[model samples]
Target: MKSYIISENRDSFLGMKLAGIQGIYVRDTADIEKAFKGALKNPEIGIIYLTEKAYLKIEDLVLESKRKNLFPLITVIPDRYGYERQQGVITQYIKESVGL
Candidate 1:
């Protein structure tokens, strides 16, 4: 399994690409579903890094992956625009799942 990088801007993705990331996905518009689907298709993609805002938007896809027990790890990151802590529900669920 390989790794993948997902970002909303091309500049946001360059660092990973330069580091020899085999797969990179960038969403021009605000379509999180499209980005999620694109990354999910690749069997080699073992990890997905998402900008925080984008994570909130397309988190349903992340949930589906969890339901199916897919192992591609999903991590949230801040984009150039900055970070937003708007996902209280998901955070609670994650905490509960981890027995925290």
Candidate 2:
């Protein structure tokens, strides 16, 4: 799968793409499923950094990734507002998965 970005805004998408993530920009929650599904189909996706809000909206997809053995690790990122305690989704997922 290809590394993708599920952000509500464009800045994060541009940044990720510039950072060599091959990021696909998603505009809203509805677009997330289509974009993510496409990413999951690609073999190049080793890590997917998505917005916390977006991930939460589609928590089932992320949870499914955990239940299944996949190559591209699903990660969540905070928006430009900065990381919030309840929305550090990526960290939370990792911590829960590794029991860290």
Candidate 3:
């Protein structure tokens, strides 16, 4: 069970690489979709990390995958630019998921 990173930039990709996570670097939205689907299909990868910008493009697929699958957990990572979402995003998600 290994963690994979699908980063949009070289910096993020290299940074994760230093941490021993293997992954791909994508440019366009199509590439993002391709890499994301590939990661989901990989039995060896237990977690998938997508850069924030990359994740923003295929969020529907991410959410759909989350609802339909239990393995290969999907995560959004901020690049050098930092988080794209407003503060308390996790809290909001928890509230939404908990119906509160």
TM-scores for the candidates? 0.67, 0.77, 0.89
Best by lDDT: 3
| lDDT, residue 94, candidate 2 | 77
Number of backbone collisions per candidate:
0, 3, 0
Models ranked on TM-score:
3, 2, 1
Q: What is the lDDT of residue 80 in candidate 1?
A: 66
How far in Å is the alpha carbon of 55 misplaced in model 3?
A: 0.5
Candidate 2: the clashing residue pairs are 1-42, 1-43, 1-45
Deviation (Å) of 33 in candidate 2: 0.6
| lDDT tens digits by residue: candidate 1, 7-92 | 76566677677887654454544556676777778777888787666666777666667667546777766776666665685776
- Model 1 residue 7 distance off true place after TM-score fit, in angstroms: 0.7
The alpha-carbon deviation from the true structure for residue 37 of candidate 2, after best TM-score superposition, in angstroms, is 1.0
- TM-score for candidate 3, please give it: 0.89
* Consecutive 10-residue window with the lowest summed lDDT within model 3: 91-100
Off by over 4 Å in 3: 92-100
